[model samples]
Target: LEGLAGELGIADRVSWLGFRRDVPELLAAADLFALASEEEAFPTALLEAMAARRPLIATRVGGVEEIVTPGTGRLVAAGDVEGLVAALSALVSDPESARRQAAAARARVEREFSTAAWLGRLDALYLDALGQRAQAPRVAAGERPA
Candidate 1:
């Protein structure tokens, strides 16, 4: 990758920071985030990027669609180089739109996927299960009730 960057005359603009622990800090400093995974299963990086208020350009796969809704981010088909390039170019060319989407992403993460929101959903599920259990026929210890 470094060799390719050097060949492309972009080594000066790129940083090959292989594996660091300060991911949150990195995300906080980014203007935009791109995830070009061929496949993903509930990508936590997408959530982190959204939480960090960075515009996203991710490939359409797995749970990406469930997260990057309209006005939140751009999703292109996996392996579509042209689509990825277009999405990145569009977001970069329109700063205002990028900012808007970033803000919306943060808001959506807070409103729907936050810790509080998750707890609320869990609470509802438990309550519904309890209600169903309560409505079930109770049987005596010694005999079954018809």
Candidate 2:
């Protein structure tokens, strides 16, 4: 890939960094995050990018739509290279829009997918379960167990 990058005259534009551990830091340094996967399940990396407040361009697949909604980012049909390129070009050409979208993504992640939000949901579920349990019929004080 490095040789191909050099042959294509894109060696300078592309970094061949491998097995990076500082993903958040890398995303912080990046202008945008691009994912061209044809299929996805959780798309945790996209979430990481959003949490990092980077603009997004990802193929629309699986749970991506649930995360990358209207204002958060741009989505292209999977395998649609032209659409992907167009979206990427648009985001790069319009820095203000990209920044706005990235901000919205970050805000959405914090509001909807943050750890606090998950814990809040868990608390609600437990509260609901406890409420239901309380509603179940109970034997009188001295009655034998049913």
Candidate 3:
């Protein structure tokens, strides 16, 4: 909250919607989710915005790098105040761009991280015989899981 007030220079305009019961309403009211967090590991907040079809502006940190790709969100280096400001301004002034990015983000999440894909992989493994599992380790040939 202090970060926002300092960045936007509108500390008085800030509203702390802490523990709001109307999640959908709150999400719907927002055009973007902006976070300048220095530490983020698979940030659930950004993921939630993607799921909610809201565009994001976040610092490029950890798993956030993997999350915001192309049209999903705009990422700036952590502590780059000017860059963050520029991104926030651009998105705020152009609602259409925000919506487009939001749509694309949601689509990417659905295609890449959907529960259906998870279940399908589980079912495929279930269908595979013990011999198939024995034939090849699940590391995709030469590639190893990092």
Top candidate (lDDT)? 1
After superposition, the stretches of candidate 2 with alpha carbons farther than 4 Å from their true spots are 1-13, 139-146
Worst 10 residues of 2 by lDDT: 137-146
C-alpha lDDT of all candidate models, in order: 0.96, 0.94, 0.85
TM-scores, each model vs. reference? 0.87, 0.86, 0.74
TM-score of model number 2? 0.86
- Is 2 or 3 the stronger prediction by lDDT? 2
Model 1, 66-121: lDDT tens digits are: 99999999999999999999999999999999999999999999998999999999
Q: Find the candidate with the highest TM-score and give its number.
A: 1
Candidate 3 — what's its lDDT?
Answer: 0.85
TM-score of 3: 0.74
Residues 11-65, candidate 2: write the lDDT tens digits: 9999778998999899988889999999999799999999999999999899999
Q: With candidate 1 superimposed using the best TM-score fit, by how many Å does residue 104's alpha carbon deviate from the native?
A: 1.1
